[model samples]
Target: MKRKTHSVLRSRSGASITFALLLFLVCAVVGALVLTAGSAAAGRVSNLAQSDQRYYNVTSAAGLLADELSGKKVTIVRTREITTKTVTEYKVNLAGGAAVNANKIAETSSARYTTKLNERPEVPTELADYPTDTNDGAVFTDLTFLDTIAVKLLLDDANFNTDEAMNQSMKNGPEQKGVLRVLHAGSTDADPNVGVADPSSLSVDCLYVVQPDGTIILTLTNSTDKSGETYSLRIKLSPSINETESETTETLSSNRDSYTDSGFHETVTTRTTLTKTAEISWTVSGVEKVVSAADASAQPVETGTPIETDSP
Candidate 1:
């Protein structure tokens, strides 16, 4: 009976040792898996931080270059590698100015003049006829001015080529006779107002006068008022000349890409590029000066016409 009891005790001791070994093996496997997951998460966070830093460095460098080039008339190319992770590059070009084209200038100027007339209010019928007493020195007596009056000198060319045609057209006045009409405000009809002057009686001297020296003159006179009132009308001309001058600036661009290896079998690539341009314009006012395509940048330059008002 003593031998049997000892055998049972030894068997129970062996079973306990086997169960403890299996439990220890399972815990070791779970610990290794947790360590692997932690390492992967740390690597991902490191890559993200590096990428964000690279992006910021590239953008900041580009902005600095752009600010330095503003309003400067120069052409240059520059490249910089801030670090292994960031690169930046830029190119700038200063385009030179040229005289405005002739045909374009004429078309643009005519269109602008027509547009101005269309936008103005119609003059009253009472003011249409010239005063019988030219000695009084007033175009209209006791006139109710309904709209601001404007006058502009135009270069007329039949084929827009021959000097003779241009001279004849200028001397004879525009192809279409200058007609004054009485228009009601805000009317869109084709014939919104009645013609105030006899077509044959309309004279170039009343609106525009051309000189033998190729200088055109515009005049506005009103002496009939008891107050003897006079006015200065805002005038705009050479629409094409303005647009062509504005387009003198030109823009150019370029791009480049590079790559470098990061640790852990990873690679990082960066791309950088830049574009820059320059601009110039010309302006002229009054009919005394001629703005030909050959001499677009003439003297007595103006940036643009002043805003028009009806008060005068």
Candidate 2:
């Protein structure tokens, strides 16, 4: 009986050891599964963060490019390239008065990423079609009388064409007779026949003269008109008389520091071209004239052959 009891106790001890060994094996498997799942979650988070950072960088650069090219009438192209564990490229194009287009290309061992961006300028709601004009008279007027009027006749003391006449006319007598005279009163559509007016007949303070070369000369007898009055004459002419055109090209480049964590490196290049054009236009009198800034210099008087006024 004693021997049988001892054998039973030994069997129980072996069974306990087996159970402990099974439990340890089960714990080891659970620990391994937990570790694997944690590692996978961390990797997914890292990839998501990297993707967001890359997108931000690309879009930031593109936004700056758009701002620089806005309201500019030119063509520009910008490019960027990166070669590492993954290959990446970017391109941006801007055309005169057109929208901006951006493209991104990325190649990696696992996947490829491509994106496109289109940005356009917004149309202004309040834009003026025609500039404001200050002149209150007819758009087209004749200035031929100026050529026939004698410079000495204009300076005659007997006439009220002086600065004092302008002031007295403002205060008294027939609205200051002959403050302004219309010579030919021609239109922008067609040229009118030259008509000479008698200097004796012109009582106004201002004279409009037309030159054979299609130049318009304005003479103001009163110095006050220069300081006080604003003329509202619109002349569309070319600037070729005084201005010349030019063109130029420029190149720009940059390099970005590598992102150690993301393993990204990039280099950017940009090329720009600038072109200038001359402004030219035909005058209302159907004559080619140089459009210049207002000059106060006295014009040369017509010489020889006094013109006789047509008999009424």
lDDT of 1 by residue, 20-52 (tens): 889999889999999999999999897665444
Best by lDDT: 2
Per-candidate TM-scores read: 0.21, 0.21
Q: In candidate 1, what residue range of length 10 has the lowest lDDT sum?
A: 105-114
Q: Once superposed on the true structure, which residue ranges of model 1 sit more than 4 Å away at CA?
A: 1-14, 70-312
Ten contiguous residues with the weakest lDDT in model 2: 109-118
Winner by TM-score: 1
Deviation in angstroms for 92 in model 2? Answer: 71
Tens digits of per-residue lDDT for model 2, 60-169: 32233223322222111111111123224333233343443333343221111111111222111111211121112111122122211211111123322222211221
In order, the Cα lDDT scores of the candidates are 0.27, 0.30
Name the runs in model 2 displaced over 4 angstroms: 1-14, 74-312
